[model samples]
Target: MKRIYTIALLLASLTRVVAQEAEQTVSSKINQVAVFLQGAQITRHASVPLKAGVSILTLTGIAPAVQQQSIQVDGPASVKILSVSFRINYMEEHKKPEKIKLLDAERKRLTTLITQEKSIQEVYLEEENILKTNKSIGGTEKGVEVAELKAAMDYFRQRLLDIKQQLMQSERTIRSYQEELAKVDAQLTELRAIKGQPSGEIVVKVSTKAATTAELDVNYLVNEARWFPSYDIRAKNVKAPVGITYKANVSQQSGEDWENVTLTISSANPSEQGVRPIIKPWIVGYNNALSRRTVSGSMMTVTAGNEVHGKVMDDEGQPIPGVNVVVKGTSVGTVTDVNGNYSVPLTSDAEAVVFSFIGYNAIEKRLDKGSEINVQLAPDVTALNEVVTVGYATSGDDDSDDKSRIYGSSAQKMKREITATEVIRQTNVEFKLDEPFSIKSDGAVRATDMVEYELPAIYEYYCVPKLEEDAFLTAKIMDWDQYNFLEGEASLFFEGKYIGKSILDTRNTADTLVVSLGRDSNVLVKREKKKEYSSRQFVGSNQKVALAYEISIRNKKGLPISIVVEDQIPISNDKEITVDKLEDSHGEYDHNTGTLTWKKEIASGKTELITLKYAVRYPKGNRMLLE
Candidate 1:
């Protein structure tokens, strides 16, 4: 009976102990609640609020042994048993450890190779220097034995070459090592990513510990959808100048949809005040994974003007296609057609049309009342002259020789004058020798050598004058036609000082002169063209007739002064033609009416007219007269 009582009491005690153990709750507190289920340590707010009844907690980077163990949570509620599970990132653990070891070994090997390569390169440089020093010493000392010195030089040279070769090999090895190291690093990074995190398993635990229970809810955060505006504007060649239409396209990635979005287009640089918007915003949505929207309006009128036509050509008289023709102040522009012709409307009152092409100087012309315009672009001779001529010539027999003479003389004179100015002028002239001139016995030349010469000369003239008082005038013959019509430039001087320069081109019937004057300069006297006689007219016996012409003068500065007029004509036949009505006053002549007149002092910027009239008759049978 004593043994039974003892056994019963022991059993009761053991049962009580077991019950107490069961009632005791185990709980844990994670400093960082959110942990990756793989190799990385992380902190994520619990999606579901932790409660006494049930909760899920995912843990990461936990030891494999600990992952399989049960986790208990003790809270201020009834004891509950929560199912638990384990997650192991086996691939991450296996790959990262192996890659780390390999990368460390490779890095060490590359470092050693680089260091050795540098040392070898230094050795080569030192050997080369030694060879150079030996050669220098051998050159300075004449008493040294030639053979010994030669042997020494040969030894050093060979040693230097060997060192260089070794250095090269070392450099190659180092480069190869570096490449291997890079590949190893990439492999290691990939391995680390693969071994990083396991995307499986969720753990839940419940404990009888004293912790408050709360209702749990889950929510997710995502990026919101928004609209971004973008546009591209361009203009085409048209008679009516059109303003740019700004178009906007919207794109979104997030699944949320947008509505009632307004887009506004405003010019950052408005040409005029109160310009209205052209593009209005429209609704758009994503289609087939692409978000886009296009908005267009009526053609905005930025500028409106009459249509004008023009031809573009280079200095060599060749038409240039695809030249850009732009209205100066606005974006309205067009390129020349295939025929080097462009027609564009004017954009602004102050704007000038500019014709620009590569390899040619740009030409700009201001819009006026005229509809027909011509633009001649100069060549960029400042860069290079592609064609040049060098030859000899004499005075004109039929004015054909005069062209070559002009080019040669101009080249020589330009070279001399270039010293006085900073400008360097280069002239390139080309003459085709398709027809050669010959001296015939009878002097009856073939076709009188009436050659048609097309002069395509390139002139690169730039000048930078030093003194403030010094000035220069240049007039280029922009156009020419007849052979007898002479076009030349001349500078007029007063009291050893240049006043102005004039470009004169005259036909037998009419004369046109354009004059440009320097500051504070005045023209007092008139210059005129000589009268031409009729080829069919017959002169009287011993007849000395003079035909006179007159020029009008203008002053642009101070009050004009009285100036004398002088005339001289180099007649082909001096005896047959004589001066009759020699005008001793200011110049005045009329080729059509055959009249001459004269006037007195001209005011500043005012014209003074002069004229002279004379009758001229050709001597009979004086057909061989030279002019």
Candidate 2:
């Protein structure tokens, strides 16, 4: 019985050793990545030598924020994949970035220098104290010769001066080292601000018939990575083709660097919910005791206790100013400054916070236990269209205050190795680059020029003198559908100078795409109230006011230009108030919106004028201002 028990224990111990040997750790290389508008899909490949039995392959260096459900593993058909699982490799820490490492080295060097200099200064201080304690040269009770006293005085004076000079020089050196150390610390702080987690591991259990080299492919979706579209539109004059340069701004902080890997920029986001929304029954009913609808317009005051502060950035890793950060379910809010930083006081009622911008998607984060919450907002593909209005918009002190669009290019341009080969898929478009790209895990935007086009376009000047004095140049392109252009911010350049930025508004279903080329200084426009045609009279029980305006446009350029002018008449909403149009200068009038539009062509050095007259009548006692 004892011999049998010993044999059983030995067998159990051997089985455990075999089980441990079956598990193998493998390192995978990221070969390619498909970055979408909101997320990214990483593809990694590895070659593993499988034994002729059950083997567990643990792949390392996976992104920590990977979606388990999106993970896919492909290998030889002979090897059957038994099971797959993912877990954070808490034991294995991420390697510090090279920049951070260099900065740390610099910091250490400066710190050591400062310490040595301070120690020298301390020694000098001690020596000075000793000198002061024995300052009385020779014994005071004995009278010394004048020559000896002079010699001692000279020695003491020169030595003390030398010590003071040495101490001052040492103090200066230490201050300089401290300044350098502070700079290194600032750089380290900026680099370390992007918090990255430990690498993730994927364990795959497989059964193979024989020992062989298996080429495995693994793909999964990861968060904190995205790409956005932007453009640069240039036109020399009205007769030249509109030059358009399409670009993609890619950014990632997925804790995994894509080193020399093929990139595919896609317009589809795999992170979005795939389920289609269904329409529920539309039941209409009157307001009852339990069915009363309540609307909230007033903001609740924030109680002071805790403060939430963070920075807001776009998907391209650029600071977004004027973003509204508010407490969820309350009106306590604050706007981000020019640096995209905000601080809002919070109370116990504040369970969550929301960050919203005009052209970016809103982000909501729960305040579970932290005070600092930084967020990166993706551009709302649908919200770009909201800036494309029919008439001119007024500029405000803040760019986000009005619907005014912005256009600007990157401060520096980088030359890329290759262009993209566009592939049209059923659900999304993909731009596959020809060469591999090395993108770091740091969240910095890397702009890649995708494609350029010189398309034929008709140039026209647009003006709304009542709203703005500037005449905006616009390019109208027909059959713009062939471009497959997405709505994005565009930089405008005309006559060899960069004018401004505008939205590449493609939300219109029409075949013609109108691109704003920004304001033209050569085309002068002015609107003035014609006092001779304006009058105000008070009749019995009612007041009548007649208003007239004249708009003038001058072509200062040497070439003739066709321009469109638009103005609006007030639309009365009150039943007692009535508005009548007297004259429109043969312009097309839309009664529904009280808008008048005129198309005209002016020769070089010529001016054109258009007149609009309207009248408003309201109750005599109630005052109404008309212009």
Candidate 3:
């Protein structure tokens, strides 16, 4: 009985040892990354040397915020994946990135140097104190001569001066080190903010038929990574082709660095639910307090739209927190959250909502019922200088030929080599880069060039003198749908100079994609009121007001140009007020909006004058003002 009991204990101990050997931990490296609009898919590769039968493999170094449902593991045909799970390993610490390691070393060096300098300064201070304390030339019992006293005084003054100089020099050195340390600390704070709190581990249970080396491919979705599309539209002159450079700005804090990985920018938003929305019945009923539209009276119309909610992003597609979104001409307002998302109920008097953020240009978007208004605020150069954050870049770098510096350059003087293949998928498009790309775990954005297109476009100048005196050059591209452009912010350049920023709004249903290339100073426009036509006359109980304006355009661009001039006349909805067009207005009139458009081609050094005349007749007894 004793021998049998001992045998059972020995077998149990052997079983425990075997189980521990089968459970092994392996390190994986991220080899591929696909960044979407809202998230990213990370692919890692690991080599597992497995013995015959079942084995539990734990893959380390994954993003902490990975989506478990999206995790997938692929291995060699000989290895069968039975189960996979994820967990956080709080006890383990992943290796820091090379940049972070360097920063840590620098911090240590600076701190040591600062301590040494302070110690030297302390010694000097002590020496100075000793000299001041023992200032007498001789002891109290002994009386000194005048020559001896002069010599002692001279030595004391010179030594103290030397010590004071040494202290000042030491203080300066310490100050310099402190300043550098402050900068280093700031950088370290930013990096630590994006650093992973705990390491992530993926456990996989697999069965192997024979002893072999298996190559395991693991992929999962990470929520901390995203990318945004951007564009650069350039035109040499009115006659040149519109050069468009498509780019992707990618940012990631996924804990693991994507070093030398195959990068692909996808237009997919995996974070958004893929379910289709259901259409509800559009039932109109009597006005109630909860109704979106409510009429106060016949004269004073009160109409409201559905709640307006959308993101407010910058030109680089980064969300701007603390943005003020207020309905124009009203006190109703709301601020954007950290994600740059805001929702404000539209009031009856809401014509447009103004979005204002410091250091960015204010955007006023007209309200539309049940519409998402995603606005991209351009940086106000006058208020603040734009700062671009990247993984690494040297200040005052003289390497003009560096291809990496060419993307975000204000002028973009050099054309980068575009090496991305466009892949059209069923749901979205992708630009797969041919060369490997590396992005650190830090959240600094990296811009990659996708493709460059020199498309044929019609260039024309448009001016609305009453609203703006400058003429804006626009490029109209037909069949723009073939290019598969996502809505994004575009930087405009003309005549080899950067003009301003504009949005490539792809939501318009118009067949022609019109891109405004900023205002042109070469085309001068002016709108002046005509004195003779601006008169008031009394006819019986009614009064007639004649309003006229002259819009003039001069082509001082040294070349003949085609331009469109626009002016407007007020339209009254009341029956008592009557409006009539005077003779020879000579413009295409839109009766619904009271808008008049005139198209013309003016020669160089020539001026074209367009006259608009309109008359309004209203009852004199009922006071009305018309100008």
**Predicted candidate 2 versus true structure: per-residue lDDT over 27-49, tens digit per residue:** 89999999986678899999998
The C-alpha stretches of model 2 lying farther than 4 A from their native spots are 1-21, 107-190, 193-196, 288-418
CA error at residue 518 for candidate 2, angstroms: 1.4
Cα-based RMSD of candidate 3: 12.5
lDDT of 3 by residue, 88-200 (tens): 77766566666777898999999999999998888888988899898766888999999999899899989998998898888899999988986676556446634435678
Q: For each candidate, how many residue pairs have backbone atoms clashing (under 3 Å)?
A: 24, 1, 0
TM-score of decoy 2: 0.71
TM-score of each: 0.22, 0.71, 0.70
Candidate 2: which pairs clash? Answer: 407-501
Model 2, residue 597: distance off in Å is 0.9
Better-scoring candidate (TM-score), 1 or 3: 3
TM-score computed on alpha carbons, candidate 1: 0.22
RMSD of each: 34.3, 11.8, 12.5
Per-residue lDDT of 472 in model 3: 88
The reply for model 1, stretches above 4 Å from the true place, is: 1-96, 138-142, 192-203, 206-627
Judge candidate 2 at residue 546 and give its lDDT: 95
